[model samples]
Target chain A: MSTKHTIAVLVNDQPGVLQRVSGLFGRRGFNIESITVGQSEEAGLSRMVIVTTGDETTLEQVEKQLYKLIDVIKVINLSSKPMVARELALIKVKAEPSARPEIMGVVETFRASVVDIGTANMMVQVVGDTVKIDAMIELLKPYGIQELSRTGVTAMIRGNA
Target chain B: MSAQTPEVRSTEQLREKWLKPEVITGSEILLRSLLLEGVECVFGYPGGAVLYIYDAMYGFEDFNHVLTRHEQGAIHAADGYARASGKVGVCIATSGPGATNLVTGIATAYMDSVPLVVITGNVATTLIGTDAFQEADITGITMPITKHSYLVRDVKDLPRVIHEAFHIASTGRKGPVLIDVPKDVSAATTLFQPDDRIQLRGYNPRTVPNKLQLDKLARAIEEAERPMILAGGGVIYSGAHEGLYEFVNKSGIPITTTLLGLGAFPSGHDLWTGMPGMHGTYTSNHGIQQSDLLINIGARFDDRVTGKLDGFAPHAKIVHIDIDPAEIGKNVPTDIPIVGDVKTVLEMLNPIVPYAAKADAWRDQISKWKAEYPFRYVDSETVLKPQWVIEMLNDTTKGEAIVTTDVGQHQMWAAQYYKFNQPRSWITSGGLGTMGFGFPSAIGAQMAHPDRLVISINGDGGMQMCSQELAICAINNIPVKIVVINNQVLGMVRQWQELIYDNRYSHIDLAGSPDFVKLAEAYGVKGLRATTKEEAQRAWAEALETPGPVLVEFVVEKGENVYPMVTQGSTIDQMLMGDA
Candidate 1:
């Protein structure tokens, strides 16, 4: 049985460190769904969140192999824990005068913001879970989506430690 | 004291004079760092990219550089030296093909956990991404295989990089580490401050076993009716031979070793049951199959040892002790997993294990199996059996020579017949099964222990793969004896073709191979040949007594096969016992 796992890794924020991590994933044939990396609270360390699909055995092997890399400091599988995950998306949609009211209605329903407005098109910014973002994209497809960019899911444990 | 002059001078002036940094080239820093690491010998080949480093190496009396014919030979020799001497082996090569040539050797060392520090010279930093001449991204190419790799873009990082390379290569689950230095960096000048300590935050390896797990394992051992100990290469890597000996003797348990674990335990001991898995002795395979508790130390359950995954050691509750956590439950499910160094774990377990000589029936059953299915071969008057050649060599050397072998039937034969009494005496490419590893490794072993005899047991096909290394031995006057068992075929593959593929031999025969004796003579080394049993004994005696490097070609019976064979997809209990 295969399941989705969100794994967070702490690593040295050095050049080619991300390449080493992604290279290991590619070589090991782990199917990565989404990956996001950003600087952490520490000055010289970064946090990488990777969402991948694998069975129990495959996921275990992936974690072990990742730890073998010298740049990787620690890895934690956050799927089975209480954690919060979010993805941000910027979507541009063609907006004719007739479709403006419908687009605004859809945006209001999803509680998203219209960041940019032009005569022919408008850009909407959405920050939510992957499911919410996917639903917002589904509704805006009928309005002719001009362009879209997504920052992959970033996650953290939900607690005051 | 000199108050009149010191009155005018300040504290900062005195500190500046005392802490003046010594400036040196990166190449010199590399050499000095290696000297600090206690690397006495280095195997390498020079090329365009490494000219500066080689120039720096010219007058360094602290290092002895053995120039090999090819880059692969250099790496393999270093690997062999590391295995035999229990020290980190050092090798160097230039960029591009010279660096790529070391790929196989690097993977070989990586698989077997042999400690090696491999240095490669790269193109200038300005031309690194421009496809410059003699340029290749060796650090990138060897990422997955190496334990760690560093590309030195700054000369200031040279001393620290060299120190870290040696530290990583020789620590934890020891493996090869590569340092790729750009030519410009090697030529650049920097302040040389030798730092003996390494501060790697993420590279800490667990060495001590947890007391809770040790107590649990001790309880399991005491509760078991039939307990067996399986040792592997980790025992030798951790220097745990004495601890293992003490534990086994105190516990009164039967011991079976993996191929790489050959010399860790004395082969002639009363409790020794020989190697286990494919081509293992009958007693060992049967004992492992019947045991209720299987205690594995420093060995992963490799597929060759496991046979069919579900059927392997079916009844036993497995307790796997290894330093690497990744190895646990990777192949088979482990009941008690203790991640620690083998010696440390054994020392902790030695006192906790209660003395229970209560398995008399199990010992008797093992003895019965050993008697019923002993390793046997028929003698021939016209043709010499390959097994007989190994036996003769083993007898003549009295099991004292440091033995290394190439992959094939000859390797299995040596593993079966040779009785090793001490650690670091038997070296072979067990995990990767690399051909052409024998002769060069023997040369490395010889260089490590100049006073001791080193012998390489190689097959005709495997011998030809690295036969060019004969020149290294001849020129350096390395007194290593090479015995080529000429079966005229790739015996192991041919055996598979005979049994599994209905005898459709394809490119397995080496009938027109070169005359090995003549080849040895061409290299200005003594050559000997043996066609019969009496001739083999005499030839071996003569070769052993010879002054420098000697090659003895023994033309043995063709179609010889290693037996007590566990056919692929079959369990260890279902081995095919060869004709008695």
Candidate 2:
């Protein structure tokens, strides 16, 4: 019965606002799959894109509960309609001289870029949907990924109409 | 004159500062804000962190300030005052232990939707986060419990924060709001620019119900054969009882109430069918089970009311109305949800709906059930019962007393036995079910209505929770009749253990509990004890006649259980009615 939902919340950019939003989720026991916050188009507001997994009831409750918070201004379920979602990841993988060519081929195929190359290690940066970044990570796993860091999903609805 | 009196100095200062804004300390600003809001009384305890706030109240005779024995009593008293007075009650406490002590009481008020403005003094702003003495993150701690909270760092923001706290607390859904003022802020002086304007972009509450939803509800009411009205605390809170009365009488729909909704509809009305859900009347519960349309006003369908979500009102198309949108469909599925003020919505609906003579059969069936299963208890010459105590109080006061109750069997009995005909007459910790809420809140209710008789019903275990409040009651001459149902145990939990836990009673016993009679006398209040039913009646009579506060310990049936109970996960129709 549970499904993933991406909610875009616009909130006042005040001190302790992030903690208030995150703390609300923590107390309500709503598991956050992924969340990212950044400045919005408005001057005094920030947009938070949160990916959460829940059933229909949970989704409704989550949205209603978020509206109860003082700092929260607006909430939109981007995943409910046509929307664009993306995530970025930088993966550091072990690349030998011989393995570099194959790694470059994988990067080119995935449309990812090799940001930096060292003697024994190289970093690949990928920016796309979560599935795309996940696929690239899976490919780099066999080449021995040393470290990986991911910026969680951020989304907005399509066709402002 | 060597020194000008306060009145003279104030007059001179006003003349001198006529051209400019008056400057005052944050503590003074807070007090002035309360006065502007027409606050009459404040309950608090002074501490090291709140010395400045206390100093501001010293000999300041503009309003009354009650110095309670503990912070918990202070908060509950404020909550009680709010409920009975139908005005926002204010409370003050210092930081750390003082602030933490108010947590339970604050949560109690929040749960029951009592409007309260709670003020707490924190350690100096500079000393905050340094583990300073008597310091606490009260704003952070109470965030979940309170409707809103503020930790004021700047002195200039005091007026706005206090004003906003009151506005937010008293409006919309009505809940407690805390303002944690740092010691430095309270002591620091600033030019007072009082702004009554509330322009919070994200904090507006919707009061006008959507016409579409109202029309849908109207249509449902006209079409449905078995329509019923389930009123909640919001009816009393919004002062919509008169309108609700009109709606019920106009539509010819039978009405039931939640515990907090006991006083919203007159108990003696022909259309009234007692409370609904767990421990409610068989007529209301079974009637809800069969109703085709359930029109709920102001009451959230809490699990206690709904029992099993899947089994609750399976046949009914619910029309949920509340001021808070989050509560509409939070628990049970709502067919027609109207988010608005109950009073406003009822006014809008009164003229639109026609008389429903179709529900005559449904009403007749409910009346039959009510007659068949009345709230009855067996009488004994030797044994005293809690229900009898409540019934006697109802008779003795002619149901004119404002009844507040502590959580447990006695509270349920009070809700069941006491017949309230007026709104705001029944105040209890229904949401939080706080044990120590009764006595202090009774103090508050008595303070609000000096002419009305106020009775605080408590169990043995809960009596000890905040019995220290007796000092204030005696000193202030609150005249609250404190009824202690001394079965010498936690009756509700013990009953649950007896039924659900195979009689393996945990530490529900209160054998070492103090003799409540001596305890009251120690605090300079009258005390009485009753071991037999006759003695209880006599003691009740004496207490009612006595001048000041009275604590009557009525020894009740030890192993008794409140029947008509719908256990957890059970449907309302499936009640455990123990053999009478």
Candidate 3:
């Protein structure tokens, strides 16, 4: 009965509001997979994309509990309807002069870019859905990834406008 | 004549009215805001950070304040006051240690859904986060427990925030709200404006029950042959006891209340089932399991009531009506959840739903169970029983006195023996089960209703938790009676150890407790003790006759345990009974 739910939340942009939202997850014993917060289209407001894994009842509880926060204005379950979800990841792989050419080929195939390159390692940046990011990470595993940083899933409803 | 615009005319009138401006300090602003809220009495202790507010409070002649020795006592007193009277109880404390002392009390109020406006002073705004003297991040610490909180950095936001704090604390699913004011904010001067209107976009509580859900519920009640009504503290909160009585009388359904819902329905009613859940009456426990349709009002099915979650009311279809959306299905899965206040929902429900006069068989079975398993305890000529004392107290008070109890075997005995027929007459730490709540809460209840008799029942161990409040009673002449059931041990814990842990009594002994008579007299209050039934009767008579505060200790037999106990992890019907 486990489900992956993507929720989009709008809240007033105020001090400690972020803590208020995230702390509720911990206090209520809800498991949150990833959360991304940033400014929204409206001034003095912020939007958040949270990816959590729970059952059907838990998904309902999550949305209801989020609405209880004083700063939270709206809560919508994006995954329940047509929605598009994406994540950004930066992977640093150990690449010498010989491995650079092969790394370039893989990055080009995934439509990624080599953001920074040192004599020993190269940092590749990829923006895609979660599956694409995971596939790219797997391809570069043999080359030895020095570091990996992923911005958890950020989502939006598909084209109402 | 030149045409004058309406905006221009209004600006000119404002300028004329403000020719002489009146400015007040932040402490004055706080006092004025509370006055606007119609707060008459506040329980608190003054400290260095709140000294300015205390100094400003001196001129408010009508504002009564009770200074307790500890912040925990102050907050619990306010909680007790709020529960007794339908007003928001206010309490104040200082920074760091003072604010920290109120944590347990805040949690207690939070669990029981009591309305309290907690105020705390902090170091100057500049000194925040620098580990300054007597500074604590009370807002951060209390965020999880409070419905909402504010740490005021500017004095101008005082009126608005305090107003919102009171509004939020008293409205829908009422709970405690804390307002942390910096010392400098309290000392600064500001123009105080009292505004009656407030706009909070994220905080509107739904009060109207959905029509479709209500119709479905009506149909369910009409069709259900074995329906039950389980009422909780929400019944008392919404003042729907009378409505409930009228509804159940017409419906002919058996009703049971939760631990906190004891006085929401008349206990002497013919169709009344006893309290439900752990430590619940035998009829109530069995009745819930067999019910086909359960109508829950204003009560969340807590774990103590549900026992094993999967097995609780397995055959019943639950229709839960509560104001808080989060509580609808928090503990047990709820079907047909109607989000609204109990009173409003009942008003709409009473007229539309047809009475279930068809549930005659179910009602008969409940009555048979009640008669067969009535609460009974044998009288002993040699030893004084705790149950006998409670029964005597009930007989003495005629079930008219407001009773508060601490957590232990004594509290359970009180719940089992005392028959309450009115709302808000039973006040105790139902959620957090705080031990030191009895004495301070009695002080609060007495102050709220000066004419009514308030008696606080405590166990020997729990009484010692907040015994220092005896000074508060004597100093203020609050005229509240304190009764301690002295079993000379942690009776509840000892019972658990004896039944489940092979009687390996660990640290349960409290044999060295001080003499109760001397302890009360030391605080300038009359104290009396009774070791036998005859002496207990005489002492009770004398204690009630005495004018001011009195403490009576009933030294009862040790090794007594509360029964009809559904131990943890067991289903509600699987209870360990006593040979009463």
Instruction: Please give, for residues A68-152, the per-residue lDDT of candidate 3 as tens digits.
Output: 8888999999999998899999999999989999999999999999999998999999999999999999999999999999999
Which RMSD does model 1 reach against the true structure? 6.1
Predicted candidate 2 versus true structure: per-residue lDDT over A32-137, tens digit per residue: 9998999999999999999999999999999988988778999999999999999999999999999999999999999999999999989999999999999999
Candidate 1, which segments miss by more than 4 Å at Cα? A116-122, A144-148, B1-21
Residue B564's C-alpha lDDT in candidate 1?
Answer: 82
Question: Per-residue lDDT of A1-161 in model 1, one digit per residue for the tens?
Answer: 99999999999987778888998999889988999999999999999999999999889988988888888999999887888999999999999878999999999999999999999999999999999999999999989999999999999988952
Which consecutive 10 residues in model 2 chain A have the weakest lDDT in total?
Answer: A14-23
In angstroms, how far off is A59's CA in candidate 2? 1.5
Can you write out model 2's per-residue Cα lDDT over B1-580, one digit (the tens) per residue? 0122454345345433432457888888888778777788999999988999889888786678898999999999999999999999999999999999999999999899999999999999899999999888898888889998888999998888888988899999999999998999999998987768887887888999999888888888888888888999999999999999999988999899999899999999988989888899888988788899999999988777878888888789999999999998888889999999999999999989777767778878878888899887776777887888888899989999999999999998999999999999999998889999999999999889989899999998888999999999988888999999989899999999999999999999898999899999999999999988788889999999998899999998898899889988799999988787
Off by over 4 Å in 3: B1-21
* Model 2, position B571: C-alpha lDDT score: 90
Per-prediction interface RMSD in Å: 1.0, 1.0, 0.9
Q: Write the per-residue lDDT of candidate 3 for residues B1-580, one digit (tens) a residue.
A: 0123233335346434422234888888888788778787999998988988998987455468888989988998999999999789999999999999999999999999999999999999999999999999999999889988999999989889999999999998999999999999999997777656778998999989998999999888888888999999999998889889888887778999998999999989987887888888899888999999999999999898889998999999999999999888888888899999999998888888778866888888989999998776777889999999999999999988999999989999899899899998999999899999988998888889989999999999988988888888988898988999999999999999988899999999998999988999999999999989999999999989998999999999898888888988999999988777
What is candidate 2's TM-score for chain A?
A: 0.98
Q: Under CAPRI classification, how is model 3 graded?
A: high
Q: Name the weakest run of 10 consecutive residues (lDDT summed) in model 2 chain B.
A: B1-10
Clashes by residue pair, model 1: none
TM-score of chain B for predicted candidate 2 = 0.96
- C-alpha TM-score for every candidate: 0.95, 0.96, 0.96
